[model samples]
Target chain A: MTSLPATTERRLGLVIDLDTCVGCHACAVNCKEWNSGAQDSPLSDVDAYGADPSGAWLNRIHTFEVTPEGAPAQIVHFPKSCLHCDDAPCVTVCPTGASHKRSEDGIVLVTEDMCIGCGLCAWACPYGAREMDPVENVMKKCTLCVDRIYSETLAEEDRIPACVRTCPSSARHFGDFNDPTSNVSVLVAARGGIDLMPEMGTKPVNKYLPPRPKTNAATRTDPARPAAACQPDTPRPEGFLGWLDAALDRLG
Target chain B: MHPAISVIFFTVASGAGFGLIFLLGLGFPVGGGAGRAFAVSLAGGGLAVAGLIASTFHLGHPERAWRALSQWRSSWLSREGIAAIATLGLFGIYALVWMWSGSRLQILGLLVSLGAAATVFTTAMIYAQLRTVPQWKTRLTPAVYLSFALASGWLLASALGNHAAPGPWGIALVILAWAMKWAWWVRAGRTRLADSGSSPETATGLGFIGKVRLLERPHSGENYLTREMVHVIGRKHARKLRGLALALGAVLPVAILIITALTNAPAPVNLLAALSMLAGLLAERWLFFAEAEHAVSLYYGNR
Candidate 1:
């Protein structure tokens, strides 16, 4: 089962819009909250409330500064999770049958029971997509919210992955990449979505839309138009005061 | 690339142990005749078993380790585990046959020879097949491993053989293994960040944006990915360790072997040569893991 299926019926993944993301980390927080106690969950924390709290998180938001030649700098928020590559090296390198990709959907998952936690799957991934649960002694990864995405118990509108559903800027979109007309596929085509580390040749299912260029006109400050203030309509003040106010108005 | 101590010892001990098995299977004249198998069965077999036990210590679930052998079809780690088991099984039969019947079976010897070499090859492939680590992703990785296995095995063979002078073939194998190791060091020296074509620009998919810089990290504290993959050793310190490994693992053992060939061979001196080789190669194996830079570290700007 560690050997990937030749082809999946569908390639379900995400398309993240860097231009729209606000770097709030809401998606990452919600993902952790939802996964920690889901059906197959309990992503443990190393230090909960101590000086430096660290834990196993399936999603993380990285912020990068991009400076184009002779162009203003742009700050982009990159939220990374499992890309679920078509040629996922993580799945093949697993010595146990725990790491696998679904044949029906291209989502790669780890069956916690069978994982030996040898960390080979994590090592094979060029992207840091997998983590070991220090407390649970098992490999933890983004399951694309496998439990919530297919649950009949949840409402119809709430079936998407926790990260996609909780994105405040609507930067994250989840759909099947196999469908040419899917929302993600359409967005990727329109925005020139790209794979991170394409030279790795993992054929990642997730796509990232680059941040749009910001020109001078977009960033320059605009002067405000003057507006008349309400007048009391009272008789003019003393001659000197009136003359002073008129002089200031002339200067303005 | 974190050089876990358990894995370092496992590779060093088992590498030499299996090498000795390969030589034994070929009926190399180690103290000649009946009891040779029994002595080696204790020395080489004990070291191999110790190394295997040490390997399990690094696993998160040692009790579930048996399941690792079940996925040999695609995983090199699985293949290594299965090959190790088979090699040891074959060596066991070979040893017992000689002890019980005073007859060395040619078929069993040939099987052990193939099995031992296969086990070491699979072990080397476990590291070489990882494309995420560019330094270990070459055919030379296995070549280095095989040569070291043979050279270290020769050291033990020299110690165990009854001949007054160590064989020229043993000395030749040692020199050959060091030459390969020296070549490996030169190739790996610049491999940390250069020559891999993977840079921070390539890693973030922002090469067209002029340049990319890390403005903020995902977390302030250490995570599993960083802890496991981003082991940083100072360049100066690594250079010194390489020197230590080369001196102890190669130069000293060769000098001792040459001295034995020219003069009377003290059994103690030969034993010292084998022990010295083991100690030296341990440093070499440690450096092997310490110097490996994972491609995933590019994401964190650590590579």
Candidate 2:
């Protein structure tokens, strides 16, 4: 069993660099793999490898077409998941002692055995991080892979979370948020990052590095034309082939 | 703010139970049949308990119900539970007083019963005050809850009045409650929808300037929407259901009660009105829950 880190005033967390992120969804996939077989497997699916596949994942990618108010640009991909907020709404809303935020690490966690799966925590959460496990009939969410990050048996460099460890693009960083000198804290201070839906007042611990200034100067596309462009204006050719062409052209 | 069915039923049932007991308590000194008061109280109490039991079904761990009463400071549910228990206790005490003595403790019973019913009224306001859900936020909710209880309570009292009191008094209370319910329905129908934090325009802090389309949802599948707001009815179907609830719950029952009252109808006719009102109230309660749209639905790209 992995022993949790020693007592601390405030627990550390992640600062994801959205500018560096390629919207790969690798973090989400690996997180599912790690949590599914871990001590308290956090990931769950309603119907997997079938029609209407659905489940809970700690990390999720949301693509948002962010055209800055007055600027001409392309759509920006926005991936959102748990920020593991310092003032988590999920923790306060839990009727049972199921959802909690640890003072030691600032990590929001759900105790499986205690969870009644009332779906209250999910409602409380604005980010939609928590999910219900149909088989276990309890709530599940990101622990930030607490087991691997704190285990003394692991190498010093390998003590980071699975998502941070596996991030190929080096977009995610994990360290002590309490320490001002910490790498994650420094990067946040230097580069102006933003929290998703900050107006919701969650005070999310994780900081998303804002989308970089648009680089493609030549390729400026109108934001509204994508839906309109999907329709074809030209008529078809002839008989059977013409009908097939019309169907094919319509899908363009 | 997913309003559990148990809680909804509990509020409606207990409200009616206490309302009936209060009105009966008002005219207790005029000594009549012992069985009459007992039957009305039992009917009212049965409906109230039925609602309480229905709410327990919504609990994640129904076995841990006892623990719910402990969190009185923070949880409205806890306060509701305590208030409900107090209501039941008062009802029991009143029942015993009516059985053991004549009209000795009638005033005290009336005071306690009215106090308990007022507490249930506060419980209804708890949901109504939630600005997050525009449907519940309306002042009409408390009025509707109060009217429904009064209507049901009087309807039951009318049944008991067949043997106990003069026919006109019971019919008058029923008519008053019936009118109150119709007025409530009209006000609630005119109530406007509140803006919940569901839209991307609201979520992103961006005004409704540019057309903001959902490129992707954060998760793959149903997290809470498929669970809480899973109930879906088409616009036509919803319209039909609303019409049915209004006709049966408010209009039809009121019409039946008025006809009975005006015609000096028999006991069975009055009983039929009570039964019809009960049936309509159940359908009305169902619509109240189903029709409520949570602001959270906006995050799922629902307008």
Candidate 3:
């Protein structure tokens, strides 16, 4: 049997790598799939695949076009969800002790039995991480797939959350964040990471990797295919809209 | 800060309730010829009680309302509840003094009524003190609630004025209340979004020294926003509603009351403005909740 401490660790967390992330949303999809099938409570969809399609998703990705003060524009895709903070405002504000942070593992979880569905937690959280499952009438979020992570039936490599395991680029990592030597800790140290909205002081455990810097030299030429070796499928337009002319020539 | 209907009814009912008592304690004569100032005070007092009962719906455990008074040290809800009870007690004493002493007790009743009104001001302060919620954090919150109460109270007085005796006091208080409402709207408009980085870097307590991007969410199920922020509303709609509230709550009522007070317009006009003020206050309360962003929304990168 998995020890209770290991089953629920105080240092539970995730480490995302921005450099390798393709923003394919596999993590979000797999997470939806696994959570909807969980025993504790399954996320539901009301009028799903219809006009009023709505369902629970612990994680969501947002795309932003960042034009740094003096730099050229760059596309930054962000996948947002809960940070399971040490001082979760959602937990503290809950009138009933429904919302709580695990002492053994830093995971913030809610007990369905105690939740009154008042939604005070939703207002207290700054990250917009907490969501109410209408069907169950309780709050739900990323559990780090607690049921599967330490299951003996699962293979050691597959013991991680469905989101981490399904990631094609190995961009997602999970471990004991308290240990300085853990893989996530090493990755965070080597490639600096940042937390969202530090001023609120929720003290979230998850770390986000910063987007890689794109230099002028890197953008001036195509690294994947040499410019000289590239064959034009179509004649190029000169000056304005040259790319559009080249594409037309290729089509012709 | 979604406005719960229970609270809306509570504030409005209690506000009008206290305002009526404040006016009657001064022994202002009504020209309406009903000659029942004492009865009007009792009715208004009853409304205040009704409003308090409605407010209980906002609590998780209505049965434990007594326990709420224990935490006045830190909880505004507790403070508001205590003030509410005190206001009721003062109103009760004012009524007893009025029945027994008549003009001789008027001074004492006026003092108690003012104290009761002060309690109502403290009740408004309860929601205004939550610095974490920027929308309620404004100094205008107390002024807005108090003015709203006075405006509603004055309007109620005017309705009963015709039955007892007509006077400029009702119309004057109505005009003053509307002025305060307009000032609150102007100040509320000036507040700007102060915090950003609903991103992980800011929310997770990580340093600001480096760039931060979300790679994977900690979980996969929908949690709170899908339920709360899901109340869809656009900036255009919010702006339009604000204009409507200001016109109805402030400009219209003020205009009507001034016309009646100055030109001696028919009783119907004053009566119309009083009813309009009640409806306008409700809309204003709704906007207060809808426009105000909760601190929790910061996590969703909404900032």
Candidate 4:
């Protein structure tokens, strides 16, 4: 059962836009809120009101400072979770039939009932996607909101991952990547979305849209002028200007 | 990666046990007069079983461990579980037949010995197959494991043997294991593959645009992933431990083993050598996990 299926009928995944993410923790918070009450593997927290609080969360957002050669440094907000890789190592490494990828939708999931919680699946995942819940004593990861997406009780428009639905900047997109006309696929094609750590050969289903290139006007700004130029070295003028200059000098 | 004590104990103890069983299967029954062979067998089997049980103690659900044996088709861990169980079963049968019939069942003994070897190999593969820890994904991982196992087995056999003089084979195996371990350290230290492949740029798919560094972590507190994977050992401490491992595990054992063989020392000397080697191997095993950098650690700037 650990062996992966030869193929899936549809590859459902997420596409995130780095250009628009605002580094807010809404998606992660919503993920915690929804999955905490999920039908399977409900998330739990330890030391919630104590000195060191920690909990299980399916999604996390990170902030990074990128300094390119010959380019100005930029801050990028990065949200990360399980990519539900086509060739997920976590699935293959599970000793029990706990970690498995669905052949129907290509979504990797952990069967809590079967899991031994040996932590091998977590070790095999290079992306740190899996977390062992201390309370349940089972491995937990992003389920791609399987419950919400397939729920007949929910409205059609609300049938999406909690993270995607709660993203304030609309940075997260969800759809079937196998469908060429899917919104995620179109976005991937338009923005040149890339896979994270392709060398790992996980064949991650999620694609990340790179930050958009800086505008010409921003890039073309003169670098030679010193910012101190706003305060002129010329002697104060004789009238109101002189008085203003004296006030500014006193403040400085 | 954090070097869990239970795991280190499991690998070392089981490796020696399987190695002892392998030697016994090869028809090298302890030469010491009466009941020595039975005692040795008991010791080996006890060590193996105890190590296995200890391994389950760290699992979140030890009672569900039986399920681990069901996924051998793709999981090295499953293969290991199967192999260990098979090896133990065959060893038990071989022991019973030897006790009742007073004859070594050559074919069954051989099969059991091969199963022991297979168990050790599967154990090695559990770490070697992991792409997440590049340092462990190497041919040397298994080589070091097998050689060390065989070497420890020989040392234990020499100690338990009735003969006054130590065998040359024990010393030779010790040297071989040491050399292999040395080669592994050199390769692991020199190879760029051991370096972290996942960077901020790769994690965010922003390398094409600029150099990337972590400005802030996702949460204020450590999560399970960080607690389990993002281990950081200081360079100075690592170097000191490496020297200690080499000296205690390889150098001292080889030297003591050579002295014992040359002087035709008593069985106690052989026992001393075996104990020293086990101590060294324990340290080596600890370092093996402590030094391995998981790719997930890149996100935490631990890499």
Candidate 5:
């Protein structure tokens, strides 16, 4: 069962846009809040209040500064999690058949009961997607909010993942990549979305929208110049008469 | 790439045990008597079993170790488990036949030897198959493992062999292993794969725009990924360890074995050669894990 399926019916994945993300950690915070109470609940933290605090988190955001030769520097915020690849190494490397990719939805998941916590799956992952829960002593990773996405009780709009829902900039998009007309697919095509580390040959389901190129108009501006001081047009009048005229004009 | 002591002990001890079994299986039918052969078999088997057990010490749930044998079709670790068990079973049958029938089952001995060798190969493949660690994803990795196993096996066998003086075969094997390890070092040093294929730019998919560098880490403290994969050793320290490994694992053993062969030295000298080789191999194994750079470390700015 650890072997991957020949093909999945639907490839549900995320397309993250780098152009508008503010790196506010909202997605990561919402993900922790949701997954900590949802399926395989309670992502515990060890020494949370003490000197050394650590815990398992499903999504993480990293910021980078890119400076090209003879070009303006740009800041990029990268949110990373499991790509749920077509050929996930973590699934194949699991000795207990614990880690598996769903043939129906193309979502990679781990069966907690079957896992022996040997940490082989974590080693096999190239993206650093998986994290070991120090308190539970088992491997945990992004499940893509499987429970909420399929629930009938929640409203249609609320059925998306917590991270996607909580993103203030709408940087994360979730939909089926298999459907050409899907919003995610259309966005990907329009922006020329790219895979992270394609050389790794993971065929990751998730894609990243590159930062939009900065235009010359946006970066261009005119230099400031000093203005000549104003002078009174009628200065020959007597002081009382001038003062009265000025005061009458001001009042008028 | 933390080089946990449990795994280091497991690989080294198990490799040496399988190597001894490989040699003993071939040598037992030819010259060694039943009693001595049985004793040697017990020692080798015991070492291998102990190593397998030691491997579980680092696992979160040691009680679930039996479940690891279920996924042999895809996982090298699972295949290693099955092969180790099969090797033990085959050797058990061979030992029983020798004890009960007082006859060496030549065919069974051959099968057991093949099983032992296969087990060692599977163990090596566990690391070799990992594409995430480019240094380990090579044919040279397995070659080094097999050579070291054979070299240590021959050293141990030389000490226990029935002859009054140790054979030259052990020394020859040590030299061969040394040569192979040296070649591996030279090749690995020149290969780009030893570093990460994924850099900060590639990891973030922002390379097309410009040169990418980490501005801030994802978290303030170390996470599981950093703790498990991001190991950094100083260049000078690594160089010193490599020299130490070469001296203890190959040079010292080969020299002692050659001296013993020339002087017809006593059994103690052969024992000394085996001990020295083992000590050297331990250092070598430690470096193998410590020096390996995982692709995941790119995200952590370790590259």
Candidate 6:
């Protein structure tokens, strides 16, 4: 049924560190690469070399300007995917009973055969976690790598989700949130990880550790210049105007 | 909130169709005496089926649409499908019985009427339940839907049933429907992410620091999220469209109906009113989709 499970034996999800994600799309790419062949290859890309290409992707990264109070703004690389909320609106809104949450692990998955591709589930999701594949005509979303996480054939190191395994900076951590001693739960407690939209009442399983504060601006002292590059110079005759005049005279 | 033509036609056409059915199922006198009973039933039933069919056009797998009926336990969309089918089925029996016997079944007619109303309510809930759209997630959404359905239902029945002008009650319904729509638009203007205690800050969980803004989006090219959710109509164009919709859908039809009611104008004037109203309502439905700013668009900094 599309109805969500009231409780699961384990809440398995990811903890993303906004402090370290570097805007690298390797997670997104490895995710596409592995999951493309995971479940009948629902994720699709259109017109790779063509002029206008549009398709579905399960994961993507965004960069944001986070300005701390009374401090300079910082750029944070944000990697976004399905948070697999305890109150998953996308699952309940599915008309076909194709979208459902597992009672065992609380991992949300779609039954591809039962999907009608109406796209209502996508609309219900506030996180843009679900994507409707233009080619296969099915709603594609993060399965939390349900196949890989419990696979027996793969090596022990390969048991984790492809995205978590491949992140260079270890920005993404996967573990069971139901266990207090798990790495994800420990990190959440240690770094004060937070939910994306708590006001939505979705009760997202995944949490994000905010970027650490950098109080002062960078002051690079290059040997050639031997000056603090962070200092702002006053606009006088000896400043930008003088340089502009010299450059204009050289052009003339 | 891209206003796909297929879904727009589905909602508008089906709303009007079910509205007409609502009137007929109330034991109206039209289907009793004359041979126009089949025509009336066809008008209502045919449009409902047509709209339902049109809805499938925008679906990725129209062939799999039959499976949508399975999840009525939780989904409003499924409930709508079930209600629509049940109403039409009961209506089929009721219309056929009346056509053969020429005597109205009051009890069955009442059932059909209730079914029609319930079906329309479910349709409204499909949009109203979306918290992802704060503009639509309100009581006003369903209220406007019911009012418009009632108004359009009366107009269609007036024009198509007896070729006569609708009475004072119908005219009042027209006024009420447009008034409700006007109120909805006013409220919609004030509905923002902040109203739901959601903003760029809450969306990022970075509000305690300061205001958060999107520096770079996830994709340089258009993805499904950007294409489907970020449809934005300019404020000036939206204002113009609203005016055009009100004038045509509301003012013209109400004016024509009133003039015909007072004077012995030609019966075809009702037809003109119906056409004008349909065109106007189409524009209104288009605006309904075009103006909806999805919450996901906040992540992309589009809204």
Winner by TM-score: 1
**DockQ scores for all predicted structures:** 0.78, 0.16, 0.12, 0.71, 0.74, 0.64
Q: Score candidate 5 by lDDT.
A: 0.84
lDDT of 1 by residue, B163-261 (tens): 445657667888899899888877877665547888877877887887888788898888998878877762337777888888888888888887877
Best by DockQ: 1
Error of 2 at A184 (Å): 4.8
> Residue-wise lDDT of candidate 5 within A131-204, one digit each (tens)?
98887777898998999899999999999989999999999999999999999999999999999888888899
| TM-scores of chain B, in order | 0.95, 0.82, 0.80, 0.94, 0.93, 0.95
In every candidate, what fraction of the native interface contacts is reproduced?
Answer: 0.83, 0.23, 0.19, 0.88, 0.83, 0.86
lDDT of 3 at A17: 74
Query: Where does model 2 sit among the CAPRI classes?
Result: incorrect
Interface RMSD of each: 0.9, 5.7, 7.9, 1.0, 1.0, 0.9
- Model 6 ranges off by over 4 Å: A217-252, B31-34, B162-165, B233-236, B266-268
For model 6, residues A43-93, the per-residue Cα lDDT tens digits are 788996799877787888988898777678888889999999999999999
Clashing pairs in 6: none
The digit string of per-residue lDDT tens for model 4 on B42-131 reads 877887888898889889999999999999999999999999999999999888777666777899999989998999999999999998
Candidate 6 lDDT score at position B300: 91
lDDT of each: 0.86, 0.64, 0.65, 0.86, 0.84, 0.87
**Any residue pairs clashing in model 4, and if so which?**
B32-B162
**TM (chain A) per model:** 0.89, 0.78, 0.82, 0.86, 0.87, 0.85
Tens digit of per-residue lDDT, candidate 6, span B262-284: 89775546767777877888889
Higher-ranked by DockQ: 1 or 2: 1
Candidate 1 docks at the CAPRI level of medium
User: Looking at model 6 chain B, which ten-residue stretch has the lowest summed lDDT?
Assistant: B27-36
- The deviation in Å at residue B2 for candidate 5 is 1.0
Which docking class does model 6 fall in? medium
> Lowest summed lDDT over 10 consecutive residues: which window, candidate 1 chain B?
B161-170
